[model samples]
Target: MSGPIRLWVAVKHGVDVVLARADRSTGTVAMDRAPRKTSDFDRNAVEEAVRIREKLGGTVTALTVGPPTSKEALRDALALGADEAVLITDPARPDLDGRGVARALAAYARTHPGFDLWFFGEGSTDHFTGTIGPRVAAEIGAPSLSYARRVSVEDGAVLVEREYEHELEKVRAAFPAIITVGQEINQPRVPTFMSTLKASKKEIRSFGPSELGVQPSDWAPLARRDRVFVPEVNRKRQAVSGADPATTARGLVDALRREGVLP
Candidate 1:
């Protein structure tokens, strides 16, 4: 808050849920070969970080943990207005579970301290565990604000408006805190051609598990995902026909009531 706020936003190159195709025969999603993109909500996080920096004067560093391909997410962040990018990945052991990823992030934060704010999405697009932000905050002993719909920095403290099922909760924490934002926060900006080109040329700092003092065993998944399958849904295809509009409407209502679609 003094000189210039150092803000870090975490992004993930997760499966593009829209583009992902499920195998009809196996009734499972082909995660291994699924096309990937930056997690949708993380884009909102990056946008909010940039907006805050623009208003309060600060630098935004985007961080990601995954395989080499994860850099794609960083590039997207850079194009959106991040000043720097850091990628924590181990080519030898590319895959890590939620717990392992939290450890890697905590290790990086411990090594490179002094970040005033760390931002993240409420959850990833593919796997919405909603744990990484809180886990990292726990590891670093920082206040964690999850499901934030509105965030602002003032008087050396971060203020947040979190959404609940029944009400909106207001909270505040000093600098060096973590915030997980939901999609309701703000719409992410699309990168222009020039920005995208510049971002493509920007240098991204890379690191592995060892560099972060994370052991090989620690990188393994604590909870393994045995399989992922799309649930089979059966729909009743019925139509209501009548000669008049009122008759048709009444018939439709009657059918919906019979099917328990209306009460």
Candidate 2:
């Protein structure tokens, strides 16, 4: 609290929902072929971390756990204004589930401590479980402030405003806290050409399971994904043909009523 704030933000390189396509034959998604990008909510978290650093005079370090390709997300974070980036990866296990991810992050903290604040998105874009932030907080024995719409530091403590469906809650906690932010907190800044170039030049420190003291059991996934597919939606191809507009409207109303879409 007395020294410069050490802000750490976690990001994910997840599948791009908009670009991912389902297989026509199997009806399952082709995850291997799908394009990947930084998670949307994580971008907001990075922006907020950068803003806080700019205001409070601190450093923002972006960290990620994924395959080697996850370095792309770190580069994006650096371009967005993070001071540095760290990537935790395992070539043997490219895909890590939520539990494994949390364990790896916790191990990082144990090896490299002295973090004042940690930020995470409410959830990843691909799998919106909203569990990573809380899990990490619990693992590190830090206070978790989830679903933060606004955050600030005052009197050596962190203040958070949590937004709910019909109500809002204000929470305060000491330093070394974890905050998961939503998109409503702030709009993420777009990286300019120069920033992108600079980010590309910055070296992203890489760590593997061995380096982080992660054992085989620790890296083992807690849950398995059976399959991913888009649900099929059938449409009624009924024709409401009529000579007059009034008749057509009446027919449409009748159809809606029969379908229980109208009361």
Residue-level error in angstroms, candidate 1, position 171: 1.3
TM-score of every model?
0.92, 0.91
User: Could you tell me which 10 consecutive residues in candidate 1 have the lowest summed lDDT?
Assistant: 210-219
> Which residue segments of model 2 deviate by more than 4 Å?
237-263
Model 1 ranges with Cα > 4 A deviation:
239-251, 257-263
**CA lDDT of 9 in candidate 1?**
98
Q: Write the per-residue lDDT of candidate 1 for residues 1-263, one digit (tens) a residue.
A: 57899999999999899999889899888787899999999999999999999998889999999999999999999999999999999887687889888988999999899899999999999998989999999999999999999998997899999989999899999998999999999999999999999999999999887788778787678886788888888977677789999999999999889889897
